[model samples]
Target: YPAAPQRFSCFGFDDVNAALAAMRFIHASTPPTELYLRVYQLESRQLPRRSELRPPVRSSPCDCGFVGNQDDEDENFLAIARAMEEIVDDRVDCYWLIRCFVNQFKHKFGDSIPHL
Candidate 1:
């Protein structure tokens, strides 16, 4: 299993272990606000920004397309996130990791990518 934040909590036996591991990682690091377990599911992926997961427009056709792309992005982010979670401990916080990733992305896709 990947070592990221969790969601769909309250699963059967297997999930408890995942959550326990994740909690251990989170506990050691500086805690954040509104950064729920589900979000950890996201952080585990090593994404640059949380806003990218939010929707720009609600109840629209374009929303669907955006969702599909976001899912793919999320999956990729999770891979790196999970890997980092495995090694990183109290010294680093998820915020710094997220900001660093996001800034780097902004730098690379500057002027070309939309506000992400």
Candidate 2:
């Protein structure tokens, strides 16, 4: 993670041993807000389609097709985050979080193109 105020509770590692280090950082008395376990190759292969995931429209109720109303859309995301936090100890799944981030990016800037 970064440092101090900018330090993130979430972590990403390419191997199992690094992930084990992260586990030790978490204390039973005061666990992190969330944890994420990711295999870069696997997630790269299963990237979510940009068109299928878009940001919630705060202005127009029907602009975003995922939910009928804006309030419901916000609630849904909060619920998902809460669920992820609850399962941090059991399993750290970063797929959904990464997908959501990509979707938000694409929603603002059309399709994403990788650059070497």
Candidate 3:
């Protein structure tokens, strides 16, 4: 038999300091294994300075056409590139970060994490 799925919700903040404070509190209260982190940013008009030149616009409309803002699409691509860069950054120690998070959890909640 499969185990039951667990679910929980925590406060989300847009401000960096507030978000970090919330994370610290949550880490101290909950087991790191049970914590789920979700990061997102609101869409803004600002775009990266290194975007490529826009593609030539089609003169005549075709049966199949893309109906969307080209600039927005470019911005989305830039965002994806930035995320990939972070994922591959040599200085980012993912395992150490996870251990630190888990240690914080253990420091407050003890060795065993309560199952929900």
Candidate 4:
């Protein structure tokens, strides 16, 4: 059978912050009892000039170890990585919030959505 016609709804925003605010609103509408929802935020950035100036070196494991532990730079990067991980762990709810929004749209539209 021919694939059912799909209807898509797009809410364009001037910037990411506005989109995030809308996501939070949708997340708030989700039922409190629901759990295990998944969401993700994919971000990208241009290479920084400082990084370009640094010498290329093999990456070391995040754990404290003697290998590649030749300088303070390694320790600094490890600390930064740990801090970033903590931030991501805390923001996991943001993903769920966005998921809730998508689910709501799906439910409201029913068969109109097949692959959001």
Residue-wise C-alpha lDDT for candidate 2, range 4-35, written one tens digit per residue: 32222234332432543454532344222222
For model 2, the run of ten residues with the poorest summed lDDT: 32-41
Q: List the candidates ranked by lDDT, beginning with the highest.
A: 1, 2, 4, 3
**lDDT digits (tens) for residues 9-96 of candidate 4:** 1122123334434544224443221111111221222212333333223345453332222243233333334444444552334333
lDDT, candidates in the order shown:
0.40, 0.37, 0.32, 0.33
Q: Where does candidate 2 stray beyond 4 Å?
A: 1-66, 89-116
The lowest-lDDT stretch of 10 consecutive residues in candidate 1 is 58-67
After TM-score superposition, what is the CA distance of residue 92 in candidate 3 from its true location, in Å? 18
Clashing pairs in 2: none
Best by lDDT: 1
> Which regions of candidate 4 fall more than 4 Å away from where they truly are?
1-90, 114-116
Best by TM-score: 1
TM-score of predicted model 4? Answer: 0.20
lDDT of 3 by residue, 1-116 (tens): 22221111122222422553464423345322112121222113222222442332223222222233554333333333333444644212332343344346446754333320
- TM-score to native of every candidate shown: 0.32, 0.25, 0.21, 0.20
Error of 2 at 71 (Å): 0.1
Candidate 1 residue spans exceeding 4 A from truth = 1-68, 109-116
How far is 29's C-alpha from truth in model 3 (Å)?
46
